[model samples]
Target: GKDKPTYNPKKERGDVVVVLNAAHVHLTHDKWNTKLYRWHTGYPGGLRSRTAREQWEADPTELIRNAVNGMLPKNKSREARLEKLKIFPESEHPFEGFPLVPFLPKPRLLQDRGLGWALPQHLALVRWCPPSLLLTPRGPGLGAAAQGFEPANPERYRFRLRTSPGLQGGAGRPVVGIEDLLTEEERRALAAAGQQGV
Candidate 1:
C-alpha cells in the first residue's frame, strides 16, 4: 500500500518479488500542504521541519520513505529491514521473477484538521478563539466580546453549534435564543443585520 507499513517476503513463495513505484502515491489533499516532516540531529536543540508540498517537489520518494520509516518499530530489526528497502523516483522498480503486485492505497485517518464535524463545540470553538485559550471574560462580558477575533460563520464549515431558533425556518425545531447564547454586543450586531435584511 502506498505510504502504508507493509512487508512482502518473496523467499516464502518460490522466488517472487513485488516492486512499488514509491513516487506517484497520492497523499490526501491539504495533508501534503499542512503536514510537517520533521527530523532531529540528536544534539541539543536540533529540529527540522519540511512540508509535504516541499517534499513532493524536491523528491517524492523521500516523502514515501519518511512515511514508511515512521511506521517501523524503532530497533535494530527495523534498521535492517529499512536498509533493504529500495525506493526509486522513476516508474521502474528492481524486482524480477515474482510479478509486481500494485500496492493499493491505504485509507487515511480523518484525524486531520477538518475533523471538526465530530463535535458541536469543536468547529464553533474556531469562531471566538481556539480551545486552548477559551476563558471566562476578564472584566465584563463586553471585554470578552471585544476580544473575539472573528464572527462565527455557520456557512463556513457547516458549523452546527448553537444558533438562532428560526435559523432553519419551518421544521420548527427548538431554536436557541440569542439572549441565551450570545453576548450583548454580538446580539446587537445580529439584530441590526436582521433589521437591514427586512
Candidate 2:
C-alpha cells in the first residue's frame, strides 16, 4: 500500500467546476419525492421544508449545490472548496471568454441509466484538430494528397458530427430521443445555432 499523504492547508485540492443545465438533473428511483430539504428562517417557528422535487422546481441550482456540498469533507477548508463549484440553472453562462474544456461522462454510465448522451450544443462549434494532423507537413507522407489541401488557419476549421433527432440505437437497445437527451434550454440553444440535434 502507498503511504498516506500529509494534508496541506495552503494547497489547492482541485480545479473549479462549472456545471450548466442543472435543472435537468435526474433523481433515481423515488428520491425526488422522498428526499427533503429543511431549513429555518432564523425566526420564531420559521421552519420551512420541501421535497426534492419541490425544491428542484423552485431552484434547480440549489439541488446541485446541496449535493456537492454534502459530499465535501466537513473541515475548515470546506467553504473554500465549495466556492469553486459553480452551478447554473440554464445552459447559458458568462465563462465564454475563458478557455474551457468540455467534460463528457462515460458512455457506459449514461447507457446504464438510459440517459443517452448529454452535451452542450455550442461545443459542436468549437474548432479542434488532432495533434498529429497539426504537426504533419504538407508532403508525400500519410495521406499526402489530402494534407496538401490545408486551410490558411487550420484551427479555424470546425468539425461537426450531426445526429438526427429521429436516429435510434441498435436492435433491442433503448430508443434515446432528442427530448430525452437534451434539456429545453439546450434544445433552444441548438436551434439558435442552426443545428437540429446533437
Point to the candidate with the largest lDDT: 2
Query: Over the stretch 29-133, how does candidate 2's per-residue lDDT look in tens digits?
Result: 356667899999999999999988789878889998998889977887789988888898766899989887655322111112334443322323322222221
- Which candidate comes out best when scored by TM-score? 2
What lDDT tens digits, residue by residue, belong to model 1 across residues 66-159? 8778897776555565666677765455565545544322222223255443333222222232222222222223234334344346475244
Candidate 1 residue runs with Cα over 4 Å from true position: 1-19, 42-45, 96-198
What pairs collide in candidate 2? Answer: none
- Distance from true position, residue 47, model 1, in Å? 1.9
| Candidate 2: count of backbone clashes, pairs at least 3 residues apart or interchain | 0
Q: TM-scores, in order shown?
A: 0.40, 0.49
